[model samples]
Target chain A: MRRLYELLEQDTRTAGLTRVAVSTVAVLVVWQLVSMVVTNRLLLVPPAEVAVALVKEVETGAMWTNAVATVTAVTTSFVVSVAIGIAVGLALASSQALSLTAGPVLGALNSVPIIALAPLFISWLGLGFASKFVLVIMVAVFPVVVTTEAGLRATDRQLVEAARSFNATRLQIFTTVTFPYALPFIVSGIRVAWARALVGIVVAEFFGSFAGFGFAILAASQTFDTARVLGYVIMLGAMGLIGSVLFAALERRLAPWRQE
Target chain B: MSTAVRLKIEAIDKVFKRRDKPSIEALRNIDMEVAEGEFVSIVGASGSGKSTLLRIIDGLITPSGGRVLVDGRPVDRPGPDRAVVFQQDSLLPWKTVIDNVAYGLTLARVPKADAHRTAQRFIDVAGLHGFEHHYPHQLSGGMRQRVNVARALAVNPKILLLDEPFAALDAQTREIMQAELLSIWQETRKTVLLITHQIDEAVFLSDRVIVFSARPGTVREEIRVDLPRPRDLHVKRSPEFSGLVDHIWTLIEAEVRAGLRQG
Candidate 1:
């Protein structure tokens, strides 16, 4: 036991891992105790039962089918929303007049809860992948727009003046200085928007999509299949965790100057 | 020394007006002509608008009245004819040392491979050899200024305008930078206009030192330093250099006192 404690305390990474594993096991024990006391299988299920149900869902191939659908929708929506957001952000940033006029309007639109727009998206784009796509775009674009504008506007004035002193053209200055300066901020904005994009796809799927993790949860819950419902919840949480890790890694790789 | 006039500032005046605030006259009738290959320094108290005059000469900002002529043409906008090294490093933080040095040439549409090759020579001259791939933030403040100087010189402009380039440095680094600048200027033979409040710096570097009065700044005196060529750290020990430094100090002292009395 002393040797194990010493090993755990040796390195920060090892210590962190040990702590997380311990907490996870502790939570599982608590959850098992609660499930045993409740005795209602529909409302609560043990961690072991949930693991079994998750394995059954996977073996039946239903998990992969639904996961693929959600992944496809997420990738498509994320790409489209980012593209549109960047184009609109550059447009707004390029001109003071346009930024002033459209900036408040975009902020107001973003202030409205995205879920409130789900009915409109369903009616306009139909209750399919189209609506999900629109909903994700709505959720993702606002953060991108706000962060992009702030980044572009906040570019160092002295840097721009230095470029201009060398007779650099407006386009050259934008490409060489403005864009690179804004890139780290843009990457951070995308990181924030990535989580929102997942939320959007899940919410949209929960309401009207033919298939997704959210749909699987809804279906499992309707039958009071608590084990399968918990499994789907765990899967969704895992997806979000994976996305956050990927973006954080990308941020570190791209913006190394910011790390120190 | 070349007799050709490289830059002519003709009766320039600058007044800054703000909403509901009193109009501030920043520069008034600032008339001077700088000859080709002449190393001139402008000395003044703080808020004397010395920087404003340099900006006007660089064509970064237009004077409210009159104009600056460069190479027999009116300078309405910044061009490749002149380059400025600001007090701050102003080196793009995103770029590596070599890329920052090559930036001006690239803007002039020099091919990338050629620009980088030419930039390497300046990188060596600026004493930044092994740090080409390092970004600005990775370098020290003095190192960044060296990169800044390299970037300005890489463009091969007719004159280098430096606004307190060494002011941010410590005394030791500033002296080292001054010596480096003189050596660089000796090699290139480019005309230079340096602005600073450091009397010894002005006396040590300049062929002629132009002093400006505080507020609505104009030339108070133009002192010629007749010190011998290729002088090193030993020159500052000589009485001639100290005498000139002291004389300029008195003139600036009177100017600052006058400014205080005006208030």
Candidate 2:
């Protein structure tokens, strides 16, 4: 017990990690108790049953098939969104005319619900992964575009003046000063949009497709297998939380001096 | 100090326009000639436009009304021939000390390996020997200022334009930087145009001090500093340096008071 305590206290990072894990478990336990009190599996299942059902699905490869499919769709959509978003964002930021023209359209987009257009996507692209991909594109683009534009616009005036004082070519200023300074913001947009993209794919899949984690969850609900449905939701929650963590790690890796 | 008229500011005037208003003259009817390798300081109270004058000479800002000539040619815009060290260190935060210093060379399309090697030489001269790999955030305010100095010197401009480069520094750091600047200037003998509000810094560093009036800044007085080359900070303790400060202060004292009253 003393050795375990020493390990837990070895470093600030380790100590923080241990505290987070313990609190997470505690919260889950409390949630399980509350769900048990309700005594209705259909409304909410206990944590133990959810974990067991999760394991059983994984063992049967039911979870893997749907998880892999969902992951691939979301990832492909994210790549497309980021590429177009960054390009458009930078162009808009660099040109006042473009930003003025697109400002209203982007504002409308931020307020428009992705779910409101799910039926339209299904009708246009059919009951397949294509519609889900389009949903991810719409969900993901806004964040990336907004974040990248903000970041690009946020380039320091002093830095620009300094570069100008050097008679730096237009290309050099963009390559050296503006782009690097905007990187942190660009990564932030991508990370935030990624969460939105995942939600979009799931919603798109559930409403339109026959295969995917969303479909499996829907199937589980129809059969009243609440524990299995809980497992799929938990898996998604974990994937989202982990993906966000990976983005944080990536930002740190790219800006090592910012680690402190 | 050695060569005749390396730079000439001929009938320079600058007026800044705000939206829907008559233009405000920042500098008017200005004329001065700086000999090669001379260290000159332009001093005035805030808004007195001493900095604006330096910017005009550096071609960082255009004078709405007159002209600046370097080597008897008009300066239309900023070029590598004139390098400026701003009030803030202005080191690119993301880059390491060496990389920041090497940026001009890199922009000039010099090879990376060669740029680093060249940058290292000046980095040492600026007393930033051990800080080559350190980012601006990792360094002290003074250390970052040293990198700023190193960067300007890396390109080896014929003249250095310093706009209150030591103002951001603490008293102790300012002293060290002033000494470092003197040492660097003596070694290179580059023409330098330093702008400052500090009277002591002006008298300490300049061969000529061009004092400007409070607003619509015209040259109120130009005091020639006859102190010898390679003078130490100990010189500032001397009766000569003290007398020079008192002299320049006399020239600007009334303008400074009027500036305060207007504000």
Q: Point to the candidate with the largest TM-score.
A: 2
Query: Any runs in candidate 1 off by more than 4 Å, and if so which?
Result: A1-48, B254-263
Pairs with steric clashes in candidate 1: none
Give one digit per residue, the lDDT tens place, for model 1 in B1-263.
87999989999999989899998899999989889999999999877899999998888888999989887899888888899998996988778899999999999999999999999999999999999999988988899999999999999899899999999999999999999999999999999999998989999999999999887788899999999999787899999999999898888897777767777
**Candidate 1 per-residue lDDT over residues A107-224, each given as its tens digit:** 9988888777787888788777999988999999988888787888889899999998999999998998898888777777888888898889888888887788888989988988
**Model 1 chain B: lowest-lDDT 10 consecutive positions:** B254-263
User: Per-residue lDDT tens digits of candidate 2, residues B19-90?
Assistant: 988878888899998899999888988788888888888787888888888888889898778988888857
lDDT of 2 at A15: 75
In the predicted model 2, the residue pairs found to clash are: none
TM-score of each: 0.91, 0.94
Please list the Cα RMSD from the true structure of every candidate, rounded to 1 decimal place: 3.1, 2.4
Q: In candidate 2 chain A, where is summed lDDT lowest over 10 consecutive residues? A: A251-260
Q: lDDT value for candidate 2?
A: 0.86
- Candidate number of the best lDDT: 1
